[model samples]
Target: MKFKSNILILVLLAVFIVCSVQSVSAANSHNFTTDDNFDTKFADVVNGDTFTFKAGSYNLTSDYLINKKVNLVAENEVIINSGDYRFNFASESNGSSVKGFVFLGDSNNPKATTPIATTGPTEDITINNNTFKYVYDGVSFGRYATNNFEFTNNIIDGFLRDALNLGGGSGHGDVYIVNNIIKNNLSAKDGIAIAYKGSGNLTINNNTISNVIEAISINSFNAPDLNATVIIKNNIFDNVETVIEDPNHSEIIDSYNVFNNSGESSLTHTPKEPANIIINSTISKSSISKDGSVNYTVKITNSGNRTADNITLTITLPNSLKYVKTISKTTGDYKNNEWTITALDAGSSATLSLTLNAKSTGKQTIKSSSSYLNGNETTPKEGQTTTILSVNKLSTKITVVVAKSAILGSTSKFKITVKDKNGKVLANKNIKVKVNSKIYTGKTNSNGIATVNAKISNKGKYNVKISFAGTSDYSASSKSVQHKVTASDLKIAGVKRIGKNYIVKVKNIGDISSKSTKVAISFKTDNKPGVIQYATVKVKALKPGKTVSVLVKFYINKIYSSHKRNVIIEESKTFKEASYENNIISIRK
Candidate 1:
């Protein structure tokens, strides 16, 4: 009976120990869904806890702080739409991992949005198989320190500035970045920007980077160890402006990298007291007329820690502007559109001025690029700023000179002139004049005057229109002048007969001259109204209120002693007359 009882107790103890082990395992792992509150779940979790997020979308409005070691896993198709929020891993959050999750950020505030960041010293943080889009920064190595980080199999498609930023802090152990895709970013200046201060081994292998300005930019660290090394191998770089830009580090190893449409790799020795060049340009007039000129000023500065020697700057003038000459320069000489600076110390600046004539009229652009040397290191960095200039066309005025009143059947003369806004006459300009339903075209002479003539038939008020079609340097203009025209009248004034000679007088009774016409005289005998003899006289142009006399002789067929004769004078129809009653006269002889 005692042996059987001991066997039972041993069996029960074994079962109890097995149950305790299972319970601990269950407590360490937790499952969450999109409907659950992450804050509540995180508060009840302990170190080394595994939180598995179910397949759904999780919205986070604020930053989620992780102060203990944790492992976050995504079940399948997990999306975290964090609007301007990030996951903050604190100092104690070492040995933490974030895996297989998609993070979305508000692209509107990309400069201020970060997907994942570190607050203090963190180590052994693994961020793998994650997708980040529309974020300012993908991952941040803390400013204090970071070590033994693994960032692999991640797709960082879009970011405002940097995809991976090693925040100029001390880093230790090994950093493995493998088999990742970083592409389709226009606002990022550097793909993996590193400014590491500590000693470590960085490996970048089998990664694909494209469409970035600089695939990898390694700036000079503040105080880095001398024995640090960076190994870059077997990476595919395509369509990147620059493959790698590292000017201050010599401990980097690069091999077996395939480049297509990616610019050549640059590696230069570290320079002592490197120089930084800054260029700024401005125009005296943003908008000017085609006949005007503008002044351009370029101020160059050396804002680096040391002085720069033999700095060269080039200015590219657009087709809308022509370089006239150099006005003033504080230092350096300009030729062939290039400006040379012999030396520029740190924190010093120089000014250059030049006059540019507005050649064509439109929006003009001026571009400037520069290159400099520092301590036997010739690294050319291109910097540009577009300064817009607008050249406007000058306005013009048309002046017309004409008479207020003109005589009928006479030519009306018009004088048209064109001038600019500055009262400068524009020569050889085409002009159009419209008068009395006729259009006459002419060009202005050297004196800017054009003469046009039109015939006036009726007597009334009329408008004489003159227009100047502007040239490339001037604008169009038009003017109108009012004119009046009057008609003429002619009449026979008196008639006289002396011996066998007859004298006839014709007068113009209107305000203008009359055309050449004829006058006739007839003689009748006794009481009969039959004409016995006739004579005619010709008269030339008669002026206003003027009279002229002409003589005509006729021979009589038969002479009678007791005969009463009637003599008559009449005017011909060569021009219009006001009345016909005053054009004829009768007398007995």
Candidate 2:
């Protein structure tokens, strides 16, 4: 009986071991098991929520957009029957992600083969750790969304379509596409592993992409309307088919960036075709000063791998701006405004310095662009600013938007905007706009914007002169805009000197105005030793407010005059420097 019991215990032990092994096998095969369908779970997960799918192929319907951030995790090898952007998370939903699943976007939508069109704003999104197989548009960003997210640690077995479509719209969809295995994207339509359309500053690093029409592309809809900077550095594209090569000129700032390979190529990617051009260059400066002088430089280099013959580098000045081009590799005349350089071997560098002569002073601007023999060009409208010599460049650009009823002692509020011709917002952190006096200054808010509080005194005619102070970064500027504080006809009257004596006459011959008037004159002496002679001149009305002109003259001491030289009008006691003009004074000497 004891021997029989021992045999039974051994047999029971074996059974227990078998049962444990079976359970472990089941767990390894399926990460999570559910009895229900995947469609139901996909539809039920709220934003900022969680959803699970069992080990099976999910028959995807239409493209679903996740409004909230959620984790859409799946069992390994869980196939998405269709991958045509099956799941989208925009806006702040960038926190959302899809993990441990295979996306197959080749199948037709059960409802419609063509995706429906819907337009609006979208948020940023992130996609990672997913397998893409047999898909057309592996994934694409929409407009109005910034694509600074990543695609990493994923297996892309095949790209039946465009692997990565890098642009959507005017939105900031610039992205960092890194560390993904792109195998067989065979479609000839846009076999481009990644393509950019006006989207900018993408860092494509350490991504392995192969078997495509073109490796990378930087394309633009319109060069004049682009407003983004692109930088491409440190990426790898191995064994990619070269049906069509990108010329790299698609940026408003940087046309295209094909990042350096990790020394993977055979020291050679594609042979540079022989190219020719008489004039091709990109200037770094923006615009000319009000006096029409700008100091800036241009860069001239050979992008091709082959040596350029007779590399006579001529920067055909925009003929409109009239520039004198200069490069160290140049041979031509800087006075004549053309730089001819020696041949630049393939992959060589050259520099071109030029001085732009600005026509008018105000805020001068010009487009910065380049054209190469390989059909490479970069262009921008309203490119750079060239200040003449004033300090307050931004605040001087005043567009006095007036309403009908801005009367004396009343207040009005309006927006003051400063923009270059290219529609670029100029940076003016130190601009102040004052109305009436410094008591009503708008300096703490925005640039070139001044809030005004009007309190017109003796208002026969009132004028608003907006003066702009210069920052350390720019020059100063001022513009006088006219506004009437009164509803009646107002005219300016003047009084003649009292036969060049120490007396002056005053008169108001046009309309009935106030008795007190602010009189000013300019002196050539720049010395602040109180040169302005200030005294109240009262004139009883002769008729229609007219006073004797005999006592309106001012005289200086003979001893001071004997030594004083070139003492022309600088400013008077009642006048500020901003209110003075060139023709407002005369030299008596």
lDDT of candidate 1 over 250-308, digit per residue (tens): 47876557788877675332344456788899999899998689999989888777778
Q: What is the lDDT of residue 550 in candidate 1?
A: 86
Residue pairs whose backbone atoms clash in candidate 1: none
The lDDT for every candidate, in the order shown, is 0.77, 0.46
Give the winner by TM-score: 1
Model 1 spans with C-alpha error above 4 angstroms:
1-274, 374-377, 397-407, 421-428, 445-449, 482-486, 490-509, 515-589
Model 1, residue 396: C-alpha shift (Å): 3.1
Which candidate leads in lDDT? 1
RMSD in Å for model 2: 28.5
What TM-score against the true fold does each predicted structure earn? 0.46, 0.34
- For candidate 1, what is the TM-score? 0.46
